[model samples]
Target: MREAAPPKQLAFDLPLDPRYGREDFLVGPANEAAYGLIEAWPRWPDTVCLITGPSGSGKSHLASIWATRSHAWTVPASEVTADSVTHLVSNGALVIEDIDRPEGREEAALFHLLNLARENGSPVLITAAAPVEALGLVTADLRSRLRLAPGATILPPDDALMRAVLVKLFVDRQLVVDLSVVEAIALRIDRSLARARAVVAELDRDALRRGRRITRPLAMSVLADLGVPDDETDEDDAPA
Candidate 1:
């Protein structure tokens, strides 16, 4: 049997936030249309858009992209209220994230903001964890209005996409990782792209702690210690 590679010392510094600009977001079958829509926002500034996906599925990243590229302002769902809608609408191009969390005053404010933006021909983007129809809004008008906004859903990234995401993240952090290590990580971790990111972050932390390189054994040890399994097999393909 081939001996496992020695535990290489990973040169890890303090963690950096993952880069999620247009360059970092991989475009595959899963999110190509959503990416395209974001890219086209400048040309269609009057089009109101709604983007929905699971938590950590890059909703805020997309919003940031629009904010930077189109000079749009972003408001958190919790801070919005009827009183503040007019000020937020003044931004002309706006993004509201976590729409599902706002209730009572905040929800009403969001509805009014949407109406005001529409009337003014200002572009607005709303992000949520679920589709508008599933938001469970108490106000019928709010539900009906949201249902009319053009919307897109970002599907979770698949294995190949996850591997690409990890490679890009490590490279952005200036860490040199072997292809075998990348493949091993992509194959072993949970399917969620977000989870893959967290695992790499943890691995980086472990390497920093030990002042060592990241090798198969080191990764396994760190993941196991964190309660992440080390089965070295893709759960999507394994026999039940």
Candidate 2:
């Protein structure tokens, strides 16, 4: 039997939301350990885990996975309070994202929640842009406690990883993308998974609007419009 052809891409509204999941998140040496930790959450010795990564590194996507898997509740850093912690947790796992931004009161509440979760045997997962040591907290105990939690850092994806991620994004959306087009975008755009995602998303919108496939020409035009310098195009002219 022959393999079936993939489905065609669909036109949809622009996705302002960031994409994250096992399927969309590309694994490379940069993030393999973190990926492993996330996948092995079921076997994690401590219920509490701290995931830290640069912005646009897909922390929220990982949190979504854990939330679904562990029936975890998420409390935005701004909304965290001692009372809210009790209500939000309600015996379920907790995923606290952007912990570094919480105010003093929120910090206090988070500290209390950590202690509560540890005592009750419930798990707590926290994510921040920076490591726990970098987040200056007013409470000594909370800072010390957070420092003790196992930390997972998501390293930035490289050009190859970014290209693969872009290809996957287009594939997921049913968009047709040739390898040349993928390479062009990957080479020219800001070298970050977040930037690659944004570029692909914008190209997807532009392609739908123009009723055209995602070709190198279209990708270049979109990148140019986005103000990304066309240095990659000129690289070929450099003396060997």
Candidate 3:
């Protein structure tokens, strides 16, 4: 008789739309300043604000909060264009997200948006993974204007923040993990918000595959599969 095929992978994943409610945000020293800036809102020192941080550093989360409060229109940097600048600025508030190294095509458009927002007295929030000077924009006017905007930089997450982020990520995936499991993974993996997201996603997939609840062992196995340091694993797994 032919050998039976192995079991097929299951696809029982739910929509992982992150909770962007003000209450869902876990503020810590790493991002308190940025959070404060977002909360400041209409009282901002200028019409434009720049929030810079590493990927998964909650830039978008804060922006979402601001958008909700200010009724701002949101658009990615790549999608911005000279033609859309007028329409985007008319919204009274706007968020231009992920202004990473640009191709210069949108430089004129962004510069125009900034000018229009300033003229119309509308508030604009711009987020980026790097500083304005590092975005590689070829337009000097845009570069200078972006530099003038009051900016808040979010530092990497601390231990407490890391643990909280892990919990939130698990919650986002609708996975109910114990504090022990969350703490174990938080202490073992790299202290990065991006890494936290990746770990949670991987754990969710692994748990779905095994049809088991998220446990310490399952988290450990998923971390190892994700190439987390073996020494880190050994230290965490050791008896107290």
lDDT (Cα atoms) of all candidates against the true structure: 0.78, 0.78, 0.86
Model 2 CA lDDT for position 204: 82
**Tens-place lDDT digits, model 3, residues 1-240:** 999755646956665777788988899999999999998877999999999999988999999999999999998987789778888888899998988856534887888889989999999999999998788888899889989999899998899999988887887767898898988887788878988888888788887787788898887788788888646544456789
Candidate closer to the true structure by TM-score (higher is better), 1 or 2:
1
For every model in order, what is the number of clashing pairs? Answer: 6, 1, 0
Scored by lDDT, the top model is: 3
Q: How do the candidates rank by TM-score, highest first? A: 3, 1, 2
lDDT of 1 by residue, 88-170 (tens): 88877888888887454366777788788889888988899998878878888889887877777989788778888888877
Across residues 1-240, which tens digit of lDDT does each residue of candidate 2 receive? 999655555667755554555566668876777777788887887868888888878788888877778888877776778668777667578888888774544777887788788777888888898987788777898888888888689888877788788888788778888788887787887768778777878888888777778887888899999999888654433588
lDDT of 2: 0.78
lDDT of 3 at 43: 90
Q: Rank by lDDT, descending? A: 3, 2, 1
Give residue 15's lDDT in candidate 1 (0 to 100).
53
